[model samples]
Target: MEASELVQRFVSRMAEGQPIHTASRLLDELREDLIKIGRRSAFFESQGLPLQEAWVGIKFGEIMTFDTIYLAAKAQMGFDVVLLKDNVSVQFDITEATDRNVDRAEEYRSGPEMIVEDSGEIARQESLFEKNVGNRLKRKSSDNLIVYVNTGWLPEEKFIEDALIRWHLSFKKKFNSAYLLIRGSVVQLAPELQKFSNSRSRENGPKS
Candidate 1:
């Protein structure tokens, strides 16, 4: 609860005991998870498989947050948060899960932000969902996607699963998963998207 008491109470009042995660919190959680994932072998691994102790360590370098340099990053890494780590650095394209299928570009052109406004105007640009799904999911640097909805979203149920399926088939990319943070909830969206093999496309894929 590094955030002020008012922020905590504001979240609690909106979603009960469940705290709504902001962009800053989401970035921190991902950073911690990447480190802990390296230590999974210390406990349980995937099913019977365990992470090897020799391959357990992962070193992270300086982190690039989308706080002030988001516009600058658009020309380089192009992701909201660029986490530099050993081996290959991980890139994240963070966006606000707009209440509609279309993106509110004006509100979020500067990358994902702490938007206090409720859903209203939204226009389509190059939405993350459209860029990386179905046959288009095989790009080299699509980047891990994170979409979060603000606390102001009402229960209109705009971003439903069925619509995602249609959008999934139209696009093409090998993005494994898209993480969605709705108010105080977190969902791993589109894990069942078709396979993205090295050579062939749309064979079979699994969400982790």
Candidate 2:
């Protein structure tokens, strides 16, 4: 079938009550596009340019989603993912009465722990709200074409570790140049992704 015909059918299937089946097929058809996007993004990184700068693409998800996709795309393009956290002021003071850079330690300790707590609480609320809204919208949209994007260049591992340490007083797992996701269409692409590069050229297209 033509790409236009396939898209229409997929959209129609979504409008009807066949989301599961339709979305699965639509993903099959778009897998090549996704992989191409991933590969091109990787190539751009080699030149120290933004992935989006090197290719034609669309932003499908919110900030968080985009962040995850960027990492995955980077990996697909053969690059390491680095996580960095800034504005983390650690102060210590070293006096005759203290050992090992006590002044610097004190400086780091002086930052707004309470402010972190307050902001964390708010973030938790917002995250919960976003999840609920996302799930509900997922259910409502028969097409099931939800996209999220996070453009902030915060280091993923550091961000998680710092957030956990600050809010829960604990450390989380470390990540390096990898994509991690909890939900959305991208997850579905994993198994069949190896063929994603040639997906658009498949004769039968994506199987229903």
Candidate 3:
């Protein structure tokens, strides 16, 4: 199916209360389609560059992350309803996912970050997840953490190692999954996430 069609179908399934796994699979397909589209953009096509080269364009961002997670929650978790309070901005976006039957609500805060060059900057991202992990663990109702990192602009090494480490050690268990916005695609940090990272590390090699 086309990317747009798949996206609509995903939203429809969420509204109709389909399985979260099913919705997530559709989104996984959607991400691939989007990457294909990015490959065809004029800049990449004209230069005969790989589709991977076009990932830093405007189409890739954290908004894509929210759509995947929110839809999955609506279908998978008991969150039958969702509310969007505002447009996504540089600061952050707020969303509320609620299961009225259980009187439970999860407040999600999501935004995009450019992984910093200095390792010290890792603390900034970790601090955000750390605060939310505490709340998520204590709550039976809602999971309050959602973070999306845009790695297209990162140096390949930082993209693979530092980014994966932060997600694996700190955010993985607490958030179910954290989204990584890379190469103009949003991916759940699944098992394949590590495999993909390792391959890229090999391809990029050590810095001169």
Residues 1-208, model 3: lDDT tens digits:
4544544554555444323244445544545655666531232122322112112111222223223223333324443233222433221122212112221111111223355557665565444333443333334233332222322233244434544555465444555433343333334443234322322222110011
> lDDT of each model, Cα atoms only?
0.31, 0.25, 0.33
Q: What TM-score does model 1 achieve against the real structure?
A: 0.31
lDDT agreement of model 3 with the native: 0.33
Tens-digit lDDT track for model 1 on 17-101?
Answer: 1111243343334334534545312222322221111011010111111221111133354654443323344455654333234
Order the candidates by lDDT, highest first — what do you get?
3, 1, 2
Which segments of candidate 2 are over 4 A away from where they belong? 19-22, 30-147, 150-156, 160-208
C-alpha displacement of 133 in model 3, angstroms?
12
Off by over 4 Å in 1: 1-72, 83-89, 97-141, 151-159, 165-174, 193-208
lDDT for each residue of candidate 2 in 1-208, tens digit (9 for 90 to 100): 3434343443344333222223344444444543444432222122332222111111122211222111112324333121112422111110111112333223112212222235675566345434543333333322112222121111122333343233221111111111112211121211121111122221210111
Best by TM-score: 1
- How big is the positional error of residue 6 in model 2, measured in Å on the Cα after superposition? 2.1
Highest-lDDT candidate: 3
Which 10-residue window in model 2 sums to the lowest lDDT?
A: 90-99
Ranking 1 against 3 by lDDT, winner: 3
TM-score of each: 0.31, 0.22, 0.27
In angstroms, how far off is 62's CA in candidate 1? 19
